[model samples]
Target chain A: MPQITYIEASGQSTTVNVPEGWSLMQGATANGVEGILGECGGSCACATCHCYVDEPWLAKLSAPTEGELEMLENTASERKANSRLACQIKATAALDGMVVHLPESQE
Target chain B: MPMFRFDPYSPLVDADPFPAYKTLRDEHPCFWSEEAGMWILSRYHDIVAAGNDWQTYSSARGNLMTELPGRAGATLGTTDPPRHDRLRGLIQQAFMKRNIESMGDNIRDIARQAAAELKGRKQIEFISDFSSKFTVRVLFAVLGLPMGDEQTVRDKAVLMVQSDPKTRAKGPEHIAAYNWMQDYAAKVIAERRANPTGDMISQFSLAEIDGDKLDEREVLLTTTTLIMAGIESLGGFMSMFALNMVDFTDARRQCVANPALLADAMEESLRYNTSAQRFRRSLQRDVELHGQTMKAGDFVCLAYGAGNRDERQFADPDKYDITRKPRGHLGFGGGVHACLGMAIARLAVRVAFDEFHQVMPEYLRVQEKLDWMPSSTFRSPLKLELSIK
Candidate 1:
């Protein structure tokens, strides 16, 4: 299990052991973590499940697809270069302590 | 020049399009249709790219093949972001998964009552008796419209997209239906304004994006667009799923035995027989694809039906496998302009099948001939009269 840390915009941080292969959005949503709305049920269609990866852990993740990047631009919250759709991020052993910052709004 | 002569509205394709779709995908990935005057994209990758690349393929002109042009900056579906994003985001929460999930009981009850009505009837048209009832009742609940108005709304909504050859030729009649939708939506908006309530209509009336609220016209168009986009397709999809059960008994039995696989069954049905076969998009800029130059303003039909059945994407794409993984399917489309009411649709479908199977677990297909309604965009059985076992 990969231990993932979800930090809310409000500075609240919660750590959960996410099973490998589960999306970050699924993990955060499964544990009732606030600020991640997988409105499309983990489909990359909706950018509601966007999360900002902590800079330190960014190196371990792959680049977002052109579609995902376009979706990031339309997210309710302002997009940073570190921004990513949580559904696109799969939990792996290499990212055990990966930290993700949830946006304040997922509209 | 089109690699192969194909008319989407032709009787053969209208009756069953998979054969045509397969041909289009294999022969001409980006075929130009002289009859329709649009470039047809059939491959999964092409459809996905076209949908995502808003800069290259704009939706501002509208997505309907029969729609009158010059609709830029109009409804959510017909516009590009940041306008599309703002419009969608404003009401997105209203149709969110949590909210739609909350309506599960309402949907289930509607499905149950509709299903129960079939108990004594030896023969029943699934579309009229059951699917329409479930779809319309749920729409009423979601839109905050009066329940008594379900039939009127359903009738008009159906008329708006009534695209059979006869109906297609009746331009004035289609326009009349379109006008009725706008007028009805305007009335609903006025009523919501006079008396605010906790419904999607009221929410749209009160919603603000950047402190700017939707005007009467905008609200009316939005409401009408939502109804136009939602009603028929949802009902059509339900009918398609029911027909699938009759066509695939073993798959149906598997679903009946393990209700959990209902979701997967629905996905397989969606992929196998996508209701919204194709949607149109106008090229934003001149683009070359497969050695053809498609100029800006040229309409392009993103063939979701073909893409869904693309052999490269799904293993044995023609085979309808309920247990197959359902992810990455473009049944509801993709990218920013994806179906807004997807959550609501999914919930309604799951609940509809769950309640329906409980009441009528088994059914038989009486006839081999199904009257598939002719439409350039949508595919539906005109009437699936079933005799319950």
Candidate 2:
């Protein structure tokens, strides 16, 4: 299991062990993380799982697909260089101790 | 105890199918319905798994149990992935939550206007007066369709979902409505192509992905399917939400007192009684579940309504608790083919309820016996007489 830290917009931080093959969105949602709604159940269709990857961990994660990019454009929060949909980032041992910042709103 | 039997088309089941759904989930999780000639999966986990595995339970053949002619491989709901993905990606831009949220004020205005129309009336038919009219108007406004023919379009949309129990297939009127909608959609697509606008139809006409655009037939089918679905399914869900409020007065009161609770209440209403009851998926490969093996080419019905009520998934699944935030509920279906208009549906319904509650905070169902739409795929009240005063 890879431990991921989710820092909310309110500055509250929660860490959870995300099982292998589970997306960051699934881990956050399943563990009751407040900011990530994961409204579409890990599907890239809904942009409700918007999150900002911490600077260091941004380089390790896979690049966003065209679909993810399209959905990112609709995120309620501001999109940044490190912004990503948590559903698109799969949890793996290589990405242990990754930190993702939750957006202010996921609407 | 009598042997459990389930029929999606039975008027009795149509009236109240929860008990039958419970029975299916418990004794026969993967029961085959002889009447409808389809295998039914009732458990929540089973439905979610089936919906996710599009390769096994395919939607390419046809998604509707009472599928209309020439609709199997035509539109978003009927196509498989790669193609389905492309179609969805192209069409999704217009339905994103951000875009829909901008329409909140307009939706609220429409809802307030509709509520105001019944200001002097003590008794009102909810479906006709409020739900259907509200949804149709919202959809037409969003799509840039003309309003004068709303009643005709609504009638055709309603008829499009109905199946003849005796014949076990689409009725004559259903076919007629399908043809009418097809022609209407073609004309609309042509007009939109000729004169592009900011509406959804125009967006579909102009939407492109890497130089690949929706062909005329694809646009036509998508338009036709959306009009019917946008009208009936969305309207039916609104009616169901109203029915839930009427039945669950306590929950309704809580929502009325605190507008914030309305969003959760809407979700609870969906989980408790979704308008979309059953949709079919063709088995692309042999799959075994609970001692029954569904062979390839066989049609399997994914009972979303039944799955939502599965006790294994939710505690006291039958109870309509406003606080229960059922995030992954099958209210919008699941997987890649989840309801595209979910954002719009949520926005419209929430705004509509908020506006309606402002005017009429409370209402009562005038009749105990309710008449539901005769459709296998969708479930909703055809008429709900309510006393506003």
Candidate 3:
């Protein structure tokens, strides 16, 4: 089991055993994390599963494709260096101590 | 409210049946559907009560006809209270009033373009040519999606609301669509990352709740929700609007004569002929609504469309008077989970009515009967052919 830590907007911490092979979006969704709406499901089209990855864990992940780079421009939250779609990021052993912040709104 | 056998799929799909609605509104406050097998609240007050009362009618059971795509346990729609609050808060911050308003000019521009595409055609398949295409374009533009693969996306969305059991059983398409959209959105997000633009995606990428950063899933899901919500809702509104306007030439001309009253027309059209039918809620415990004792976890439906026609709520409720004040119509939904994209929906319709009437005045309706979207969740024309003679 891969240990995944979720930090809420209010600074509360929840560590869950996220199974490998599933995307981070699936992990959060399976655990009933409220912040992720995933309205379009795991499809990167919705961007409801947006997350700001911990800078340290960025290198191990797959670089975003051209299509994804364009969709991120539509999110309500501000664009930043570490911004990544959670659905695109598969939960892997390489990223065990990763932390994510919540956005203000997605509706 | 009752098991009214109205095949919205066949011909006469555009006919206005206010009398039928009034009867249901007066008599059946709450009735059990034998076919749908769910408790439906049709009266206007009852519909409002269900929507307003979150504890009694919960969204945690999910909103889509079946399990939401890629959703395993409880997603945003199926949860209540703190859980819903957390998700709603994030979404609200991104879809603020000012942000949606700022996009009004853009939405109008899209509506004009949609109408433009239908120029000179004698007959047009309203759903495929106009409503689906136009709404898809506008929504993806809002999401900053490239215009390359829009038709495919629209097709996928249409597939979602279909009822035919075999088609409904095909889950792979939806799952495939989810993955494709996630990929598309991710790529779009990356562009803003490299060279940050003024789009919402750029803003979300940089947003911070409490000094921490949003992970990948949050961004993707938010984008997905916006795209899906924007897609169905806009298309649904447009189809219903066209169905009403074409059928009632007088009401159409009234709006054309007074463009400023486009909003009034939209409000009336929605109240009189709402597309979203059941605001489905799952029961939390043993609760008695009207008379029936609803079992815990049973699906309790709030029939907004029926509610709008309820005679108890409005005098002459069966009449489609554009000028009448449609107070408390449950069209855009209610409470915390109320349609947050209403700002955009209103703007879209207001602009659509303004432009539609300007270009295609007195367009003739095609004889082909319209097909209603099959899913129990929503009630919009799947296809409506219109002839501009």
Candidate 4:
């Protein structure tokens, strides 16, 4: 199991075992993480499932797509250099110990 | 009441049914038929009267259509005042005219994009490819949701609206759509809370008037209501309207010649072949309408389409004349609980017509057509094949 540490909106951190091929958004939402809202069901239409990648994982994951970037611009949270739509970041075996910070709100 | 067995989606329903509408208007101000099983008000005067008399005709009894068991009543269209007033107020503030107008460029831009994808196609289905694509784009813009998973959400939502006997039983698609939308709303609420902005959802979450706000059910219901209303009305609307333009080239040419004529086209279409068919309401008190006593708890159908065609109100009612200066048409409804999102829906549909006229004049030359799913209380054309060939 690839371990992923999700830093929730309230600054609480928990490590969950994310099987490869599952998107980070699905992993966090299914685990009842409470903050990541995949409103568009990983379609990238909604920027609700937004997060900032930890240092090591930023270089490991693929770059954000144009659609995701456009959606991110509408997020209530501040856009960061590492801002990534969680739906776009697929979990892979190489991403063990990966961490991402949840945005302040999904409302 | 004169019974011609007419419903808009019925195959026998002609393009012009003014004679029947006249008979209905003359014979039945508030007539009850055992066959239809509900009292229907078919005259323009009675229709407007019913809408204005919300005190007697409460929406809380539910709209003209029966829900799929667990659910009852409409979110905005079927509810009466007081609570309805508050809900509409909140919704109007969020879905203000300025916001809908701001989306005009985005609406036209989307139509342009869809036109690009459809540039070379010939003899194509207009509804799925053109109308829905264009309609949903504007819908999402108005919804303030992102544009991905558009098809999935639409498909799921459609299933959720079905009320067939099979659907009344445990149905996977119907259940999934409802669950998905609820989940979607919750997710949107969370995101908006985390990152507040000027968007409608953010506005809804933060909005307060006299320190009052919506409860959780009100929030969820309102959000889903807006989404479904836009989705159902627009997709079905453009399909039928496209077919009409295809069949009536003169009207098409007129609209093409004058962008302003499209507004008339929109109104005439709503009058002629309504996308929104009927909204039902139950009587709150024993009321006397047209000399017939309708007791409290009786549901009545306010037939907007029928009233629009009533000869006494509209001269040459069934001629499909866009220049009729349509007035008192219940298409967007009337009185207090009228659609708060009327501006948005009208703008989206008209933009579709205007943009299509500008980009592709031959848009009406359709190839084949598809049927929208049927409902007891509504009529929506599902697909229209456009002939780009």
Better of 3 and 4 by DockQ: 3
Clashing residue pairs in candidate 2, if any?
Answer: none
- Model 2, C-alpha of B65: deviation from truth (Å): 1.6
Q: What is the TM-score, restricted to chain A, for candidate 4?
A: 0.95
Put down candidate 3 lDDT per residue, A24-46, tens digits, no spaces: 66566546566665543343445
Can you list each candidate's DockQ? 0.09, 0.35, 0.02, 0.01
Best by lDDT: 2
Judge candidate 3 against the unseen true structure and give its global Cα lDDT, from 0 to 1: 0.66
Chain B TM-score per candidate, please: 0.95, 0.98, 0.85, 0.88
lDDT of 3 at B170: 31
Error of 2 at B43 (Å): 1.5
Q: Write the per-residue lDDT of candidate 1 for residues B1-389, one digit (tens) a residue.
A: 73577787676777888888888888878888876779999997688767767888888888876673233456777878766766676777777665667778777888888888877677778888889988888887777787777787777777776554644432666668778888888888888888998888888779986776666666778888778766788988888999998889999888888888888898888788888888899987899998889998899999888888988877799999998754556777765776778878888888888888887788887778988866788888888987778
lDDT tens string, model 2, B245-294?
88889988988999888889998888899999899999988998999999
- Model 2 chain B worst lDDT window (10 residues): B44-53
Q: Is candidate 2 or candidate 3 better by lDDT?
A: 2
| TM-score against native, each model | 0.81, 0.90, 0.69, 0.71
Alpha-carbon local distance difference test for all models: 0.79, 0.86, 0.66, 0.68
Worst 10 residues of 4 chain B by lDDT: B8-17
**Candidate with the larger DockQ of 2 and 3:** 2
lDDT of 3 by residue, B150-265 (tens): 88777666655544433433366656766676676677778878877666677766665445344576666556655666777678878888888888889888888888877777
Q: Model 3: residues >4 Å from true position, as ranges?
A: A1-107, B1-28, B72-76, B165-196, B202-206, B210-218
TM-score of chain A of each: 0.96, 0.98, 0.90, 0.95
Q: After superposition, how far is residue B97 of candidate 3 from its true place, in Å?
A: 3.8
